[model samples]
Target: MDLINGFITIFSSPITMLFIVMGSVLGVVVGAVPGLTASAAIAMLVPITYYIDPLSALAFLYVIGKAGRFGGSISAILFNTPGTTAAAATILDGHPMTQKGQAGKALKTASISSAIGDFTGEILLICGALTIATFTKQLGPPEYFAIYVCAFLIIGSVISSSVLKGIVSTLFGASLAMIGLDPITSEPRFTFGTIELYNGLSLVPLLIGLFVISEVFTQASHDHSKDGRHDTIKAKNPDDDHLSMAEVKRCLPFIGKGSAIGSVVGLLPGVGSAVACFVAYGEGRRKAKNGDKWGTGVIEGIAAPESANNAVSGPSMIPLLALGVPGSTIAAMLLGVFMIHGIQVGPQIFETSGDIVYGLFAAGLIGIVLYFLIGWFGSAFIGRQIDKVPPIMIYPSILAVACVSAYTARSSLFDVGLACLFGVIGYLMRVTNLSTAAAVIAFVLAPGAEQALRQSLLLSDNGFAIFMDRPVALAFFAIPVFAISLRIYSRMRSEKTPAEMLDTA
Candidate 1:
């Protein structure tokens, strides 16, 4: 009953409607712009939320997060530029589709897939957060350590362009994570007396540099794939953007499953949108009869990552809402917004702040519709802008914004210098094909993993068996092992496949 009433309170307002539309449109616009990401958009907007109620505040961020994610695909499809790093997978096939003049079909597939993913995530949040939290509580150090091992060996192994490179990247990220103060001992391990190194590396500027800055330089430096066509950008593709009525129905199942993968993957700690989208794309590819055609402009290729990446948006909120621990980088920023506002984000949020919780959910559903309305109706006009918006035009603005955002982190010019320094590091990592995902995930999990390990060990008198003593921990143990084992099996199978022999020809 309260859920119903809460929805009414949020939905009945004209202002809320305005925010939903504004957030969706703006998120898409921002996300479509290279260097302007969903997290940056939401982080920039956190200040405005202070004037609004919690429900409205979250509604704005949620709508923007959903819309911005889809918007990232636009650049990925047209220019092979992923507005968000998660959209990297989309570029594999989406850009190929654009080259084939099927940009309309690609956009349609992306929109529908994204919607399904959004629904899947929200449904999970509504149905399973409490259960999942109760279950997740048993994840002690050993279990968590196992999970990291799985992400490194399993997720990272399959994700990189190559397994050796991926393993190397995972270790690289872990090593960077180890640079900060030793959690158990208070002594700085890798700082070598550098005060800036004492707190370790900050992720935001690092993210800004690694993704946005690297791409800018890559674009400026290389013109290999530049089509003369981007120079004549417009809103809609008149000849080939529209999909046939029957074509839409065919891809729904893949889209639905992709969304499910995104949402489910997003909820698991340490798994980001990239992993969710990759794993989802892998499944969609595996299930495809035209699996061989997957990386080469297939609709399934476009749909899988598109849906999975967007689907991660809704359930990505689950951890933040249920446990106050964020599930993604953007979620971490959103967590900061809540903390800045002096609000706790847990079960009581539903009980004491029922309207806010319910309203946010309701807003999420509405945001889905709004996102489609923008994509289906507004995308062509937006899509055509690719020719008009040059990387050079946007780079200066983004560089300014990045510097300012970094400077905002304590009004320190030193932080601004640090941001630039990390930007260079980010570029170097990309050149080396290092896994930035591993680096960020390790950054997030390292301290907690350290803390949990130390506390659990003390409680058990140094007995390592405490992990096995709990059923939930035991179950958690299976995921990483299974994930790693599957990767190894898949790698072995790929090595011996008929295609492997054909490659020698």
Candidate 2:
């Protein structure tokens, strides 16, 4: 009944409908452009949400996130360049299909599989988030703190190739998050005597800097002088441009499996679409009968990764809605939006803002249909248009927009400067293989973790031993320890040479 009202609310508002449509179109265009991600687009546009109503803002950004994941496949198939990191796995077979003159078929397969996978994840989100939130609401401060610790460790350990670097990145973000006044004490901590610093760094500027401006800086560093025109491969046969029923039937199993894998991955904080897509692709190949053909223009190959990539969109919101922990970079940005609108997230969200929550869910359903239609009929055209816009032109414009957006957040020049500073830091993190995503997530989660820990301590008569009394807290604490140990064991095993293995035998 709430959901039906949500649909009615959206359908009745022309402005809301217009924003959704615009978001769908813009998300595709941004995602189709190589080096431009949905995260960057969202970060740049987040400041704009300050002027809009909460539902419209949430609906617009939410749809963009959904559409953007699908749009990445456009560049991956047409140009062999992944528009976002999640689309990297798509390139394994997507570009190969284009080279084989089956770009249309691959795009169609990707669109269908992505829609199916995303739909599956959305159903899980609608059903699962509230249920999870119900359970989470029963947890005390000890449990919440432990959960935050688990998130910090798991995100730091898993997001980057090097565990040390990932941990360092997370610590860096936590340190930055500490720069404001102490919340409980109301005492200045790391302000360094600046009035603005007393309130803490603005998230809008920080996000714009890290995701949007950083990408601009990275792209500006690249040489586009030798870049030439990429010709679109025409289908050799008319059938090559069309997907048949048999092909869809054959791809269904892989699509289902990919969606499942993606949903599970999305439940884990900071294990993002990039990981989900690759994992799904690898699993699909392992289970497929003609696995050897995976890399050679197989429509099944396109279906697997594309499904998993987009499927992460919905379930990734579960943590935020349930536990107030963002599971992805996009979710982190949305956290800022929720705060901006004075809507408290977490278990009480459905109780407090049930209409808005249900409305957002309805908007997501509408977005899925809209993006699917656009992807099915116009992905090729979007790809061609994006291809014409050179990196030289795009990055500068993005840089300008990022700067303007940063400034717009607070109408402060200091925020713009802060953004530029973080852009350099973000670029450095990128070049050094550090997880910027981990840093952002940590920045968002750290304050809550600190509060929870402090509150738990205050409640405890036996100091640290209080955690021992709670089985749930203990379980949460044990997770990171177990994960880190397992990671170390795996690394050691992988590092062993053939000679070492033989000697051990």
Q: Could you say which candidate leads in TM-score?
A: 2
Q: In lDDT terms, how accurate is model 2?
A: 0.90
Residue-by-residue lDDT tens digits, candidate 2, 1-505: 8889999999999889989998899888888888988998999999999999999999999999999998999999999999888899899899999998999999999999999999999989999999999999999999999999999999999889889998999999999999989999989988999998999988988898888888888888888897767898899999999999999999999999999999999888888888889888888988889888888889888898889988898999999999998878899989999999999988889999988888899899899899999999999988988888777877888888899999998899999999999999999999999988888989999999999999999999999899999999999999989988998999887886423432332
lDDT comparing candidate 1 with the true structure: 0.69
Supply candidate 2's per-residue lDDT for 250.
97
Enumerate residue pairs that collide in model 1: 104-241, 117-259, 230-387, 234-384, 235-380, 235-381, 236-380
N/CA/C clash count, model 1: 7
Clashes of each: 7, 0
**What lDDT would each prediction earn against the true structure?**
0.69, 0.90
Could you tell me how far off, in angstroms, the CA of residue 45 lies in candidate 2 after the best superposition?
A: 0.7
Q: Write the per-residue lDDT of candidate 1 for residues 230-274, one digit (tens) a residue.
A: 632333556467766676666776787888888877766546677
C-alpha lDDT (0 to 100) for residue 417 of candidate 1: 82
Q: Which consecutive 10 residues in model 2 have the weakest lDDT in total?
A: 496-505
After superposition on all CA atoms, what RMSD does each candidate show versus the true structure? 5.1, 3.0
Candidate 2's C-alpha runs over 4 A off are: 495-505
Weakest ten-residue segment in model 1 by summed lDDT: 496-505
